[model samples]
Target chain A: MSRGDWASWLESWRQQLVLWLESTPAGDFVNTYTWAWPIAESFHFVGLCLLLGTVGLFDLRLLGFARQIPLPQLHRLIPWGIAGFSINAATGSLFMAAAPFQYLYNESFYFKATFLSVAGVNVAVFYLLFYRKIVPLGAGEQAPWPARIIGGVSLLMWIGVMCAGRLLTFYRPSFRFF
Target chain B: MDPVFIWLEQTALSVWVRESPSMFAFPGILTLHTIGMAFLVGLTSAFSLRILGFARRVPAPEMLKLVPVVWFGFFLNLVSGFLLLLAYPTKALTNPVFYLKLTTIALALLAVRALGRRVADLSFRPVRGWPGDRVLASLTLGFWVVSVTAGRFLAYTHSRLLASDF
Candidate 1:
């Protein structure tokens, strides 16, 4: 598509999304309640902690940070991390619905979303390609280079997500193109 | 307290933390604070869950290696949190919820220490843990949740934005 066509298409899509989200009760709860925003924010932080704790720790183990931890024993913690991710997804969607324009137009939101995707894909790659290799390695064994790289990527991506999420409020997109 | 806030607010460091245009100022520090929080609470909670029988096969003593990292996280938060307090003295000190946040942190710290001592006791061995360790772990988790809630509420509950605002 031409540049102008792309921009117009984006504009129309954004407007429609805003119209749809504005009607959702998630936005209404956020807009109408006094404590709703802060509470959601708290839960979001909690979820991030849980994710970092289980999944992040597992990453650290893969990177050979805490070598004393048995890989399978530590892998048990992944479920809690999944739960954390679910909580964040729910709250994060609620936030976008609450103020669609704030997120859709913000550059930081784009970066955050990209980082989240990288983290997600990185997980998939680890489980599909690298899981079997790490399963046999007992405590204090060095993880292969592939696992280490994946762990490093996961750590950096999550940190990037957090940084971009924090900066979202600061970057209000003043668009002349769209 | 008001006089103390007024004086602290005008200090050069406080001024820089509050008004610096650099992202390294308020935004960077807040981000660091959050990262510290994730590591500190996350690692501790994971350790606690293990003791609570969530990950039973993992030997308890080996997990003690994580203590230093948890303390490192705590150190990061302590420094960042202090800088944040310096930036907006009255904003935090005046809010009752701020006090609540502090109290919860104190309680959480105590719970953490107790839990750690119990875990360390399990060193070089694996047993059911100390008699009350499960209760201690549960309390630690609860305190962390309360602390996190209180910390988030601090932004919304403060009546004063700056010492000078009053």
Candidate 2:
């Protein structure tokens, strides 16, 4: 699609999101959720740490650091990482529901979402391609080249997600700005 | 303590952080703090899990080397976090959630340091068949995760925004 088409499409989505957000009564307990936003945001950050912590270690290992650690054992951390991602997704949805237009129209938010999607796909691909081969291997076994490539890609994708997420506030494109 | 808070509120750095027109001032600092949290908490939890025997092939002591990387992240957050606190001393100090966050962080750091010291004493080889060691590692990892969660909640739960009556 052309840039204009893409922009229009995005704008329509933004409008729909804003309508949904506004439909909820502002004074409703669910709307305010008595400290829900902060709590969810906190959980989001916590999840980020958990996800990154577990995945980053395995990626580092694939890059050949701490060679003595078995891939399977290190892979044990993946469940916690997945749990963290789940927390983030839940909290993130709440934020979006709370202030849909603000995020939907924001360029930084767009980039963050794009990066997050890419990271998710990268992770899925990693497991699909390498998990079977690597899981049953003995300790100290070198990761296959495909696994190494997947690890490297996963690392880059996540770092991109982090940087883009951090840059969101800086790059928000408001309607006024447009 | 109130006087100290009042004085901090009047400090030049605090004034600039809170009042500067540039988004780069407060917003940028907040962004940096978040990023630092990602790396610091991320790497520390990773290393802590390694110590707990999550990745046995990775020598426990070797994982200690990643400690420096984790510390680098922690230092970044420390600086950024202090800047944030300085900007609004009362906002943080008066908030129950902030205290919880601080306490959680302290526990996480203590667990990490204690675990690191133990890891450092070990040889590169795995210390096989010690269940307690794994438990310690798991707890250390869990503590850091909880700390991160608590810290995030601080933003939601703070009761006050500034030190002044105005």
Best by DockQ: 1
**TM-score for candidate 2:** 0.79
Model number with the top TM-score = 1
- Candidate 2 local Cα displacement, residue A124, angstroms: 4.6
Query: Per-residue lDDT for B1-166 in model 1, tens only?
Result: 8889989999999999999989889989998899899989999889888878777877776776778878988999999999999999999998999988888888888987887886776562554455588888888889999999999999899998875763
Clashing pairs in 2: A42-B152, A68-B57, A68-B58, A69-B57, A69-B58, A70-B57
Candidate 1 lDDT tens digits, A84-128: 999999999999889887888888999999999999899999999
lDDT, residue A128, model 1: 97
Instruction: For model 1, state the Cα shift of residue B71 in Å.
Output: 2.0
Each candidate's B-chain TM-score, in sequence, is 0.94, 0.86
Write model 2 residue lDDT over B41-149, tens digit each, in one string: 8877777666555555556666665666677778888999999999999989988767777877777787777777766766635643156556666776677656666
What TM-score does each of the candidates earn? 0.94, 0.79
What are the candidates' C-alpha RMSDs? Answer: 2.0, 4.1
